[model samples]
Target: MKKFWLSLLSIIIPASAVTFEDNDTVVLLGNTVIERAQKYGYLETAINLSARKKKLKFRNLGWSGDTVFGHARSYFGPPKEGFDRLKSDLTELKPNVVIVCYGAVAAYDGQKGLTEFLAGYETLLSMIQSSASPREIVIVSPPPAESLGAPMPDMREHNKRLALYSKAVGKLAQKHKLQFADFFTTLGESKGLTDNGLHFTPEGYQTAAPKLVEALGLSVATGNQLQSEHARKLREATVAKNKLFFFRWRPANETYLRLFRKHEQGNNLKELPMFDPLIADAEKQIEALKKTTLSLK
Candidate 1:
């Protein structure tokens, strides 16, 4: 547990900037913007290159259309059930660093949902602190929605809401003494960044990857590695590992295998952990690919 001391005259201080130490396990959590990164693998590749010499592990737990309340994660259960699932996964992952990005979907609710968004986010931060006790927590604001010309309604008003939510995220980060990454301000509505003015395209993720690395206080000097065939291999391995881990934790047939209907298929529950070695093996391949690239440097 991290300790804090306060003087009668001083305000609460924020934690130091985020850094990826050797052997760190990082968990990326959020909604569509984050979940889509796995498809392109650019974000993780950028981070890996930046931490080339250091052996850092990344587990992306992003759920599409998720919110601070974990609404999207719930299946045949209440929001609390989803919250519990998220808590369990975080505890199991034992991440040294937790990066969270939200507010885009909630921002759609606009001002009426702002209070709930903040409260839910606070609850989430508390759960993360207690569940993982990570050395660092990074709060990332969602990127602004874009307008891709005809058929796409101008999203300037939506961007305003996002800006408001991002501001609140920054304040909350300070209150919790965590690091904040202002992607809303940093990657504001660039042309061709989003496919439908919301989700990022493959090219968009590639462009935004380095920006995310820089925002996390990681170096962008190895950014050129992103263009190499070696980097492609590393990214492919990363995607495979992510697929294995995803099925391990959030299997498509959870209802029959591990939930209320488990009486019929629960016997196969043992198959869940079977992915562990496969995931580990995939990670080893990724590390080997990264090392080969580094040796050439």
Candidate 2:
């Protein structure tokens, strides 16, 4: 029976048929899972290596503890402001692909949150379509939370709740004809994969990176290649670029610069655009490092 259902899903989901084009800008949007990825660069590094032949640009727009409602992104403003920021960022990036990783935060609300979660996710997709007109959108399910035992709470029941949300996400993807990556099932609960039964450790991100690429129906790099010195350099450059882009969009003191207190230091807002050239330079380094890695491979 399990095998039968799995086969049925393969037919319904089309999980391994999507591809990326040259020069495509891919944006990662979600909560902590996506946000912390930028720090390790494993996810970005894996995708870059997988699509080494293509000149892909990546932007990590993940905000810690964010939701479909853009709650974490709102800062001092109302939740609507956060939603607006998401739209603005997407419009500005003009991404060719947007990979959304949500549900972990929403699943905390359990059954009651499912309906609202699905609704918000649908609205977010609509917003992405209208704002960026992306060539493709991929929705990813949050991986199962781990259970470290002892003082840490066992998340076995929580994993069940996450499974419900993950399945709903897959259905939503089918309805929209968007790509779906079910990490919840593919990367099931594992010991030492996370620090707090939620966020991943450095090694955790590295280990899960390739699984993410595989879920996207893309090629995967060998273990040694991904850990090579050249690959590490590429990841470092990628992280630097993401940091610059982060500051570019979510500048410090946003309240004083562009929000309610802009009257005091709004003129400094002009400095924000200066990060573009720096970001571009970082991209060049990343591109160069990628070529070097490929040459060796």
Candidate 3:
């Protein structure tokens, strides 16, 4: 009976893998643009849809306030920690598709300054493609951050640079024969979807997720009821687990959010407790699972 129950569980649960052959794994990496999706629960929505549609798995590695070039900078001394961590994170995640969204920070200079930014971005993509061997790579340009009605000094100039950056990325995608999602073009048409000229509202993600799906060519109907049912079950379980985790960490999250908001607004920094221990433990478990999944890919 125990063996029977174990077999039943195996049949019910989708295999934990990140490869294209069994499960579709997508990793979204960027700055605040990607953070907005996490905040608005769009990651959950996309994962559920993928599970329902194609039994796909998804992971997000987006960090707020990250620039295309910022990753190569050091917070303390030499040795770029951010970019190193990014490479490790990608290796651990081993996604089937990598969605790169960035440029808000890179376009801050009031000049046509995408030359260095694009070079760094291309390097990052090359590193990932060579190391991970994902089936597809998707480059999504940054959307227009809101103007915030205060007449930003470099808004127009920055936007222009972003447009050029988008074009460059499109060309790179073509050269690599990879798919590109024109988020900058699509999001520029709508001015109401941004919060403060950078982050996205829930509606923005609602518009963008389907576009991402279409770009990946995974939008076809699988017509598999069993897969749909399994995906629904997995989504429910993941959501329930997330809710519990959120409840447990709500206080810390709220405090962090408040401090994070202040930091983003260019306010003076304040002392905060180190989150490395807790975050590191969670990441270890996640990486272990991700590695097992990568082997499948």
Best by lDDT: 2
Question: On TM-score, who's better, 2 or 3?
Answer: 2
Q: Please give, for residues 48-158, the per-residue lDDT of candidate 3 as tens digits.
A: 444332444446566678866445433344446667757766786678878787777777753456677778887888888876788877777666555657664435555
Which candidate leads in TM-score? 2
Model 1 scores a TM of 0.91
Candidate 2 stretches greater than 4 Å from native: 1-14
TM-score of each: 0.91, 0.94, 0.62
lDDT of each candidate versus the true structure:
0.83, 0.87, 0.55
CA displacement after TM-score superposition, residue 69 of candidate 2 (Å): 1.3
Q: Which tens-of-lDDT digit does each residue in 160-258 have in candidate 1?
A: 788778878888988777898877765754578888998889899988888887767667735356777888888888888888888887898988897
- For every candidate structure, what is the RMSD over all alpha carbons to the true structure, in angstroms? 6.5, 2.5, 14.3
Rank order (by lDDT, best first): 2, 1, 3
lDDT of 1: 0.83
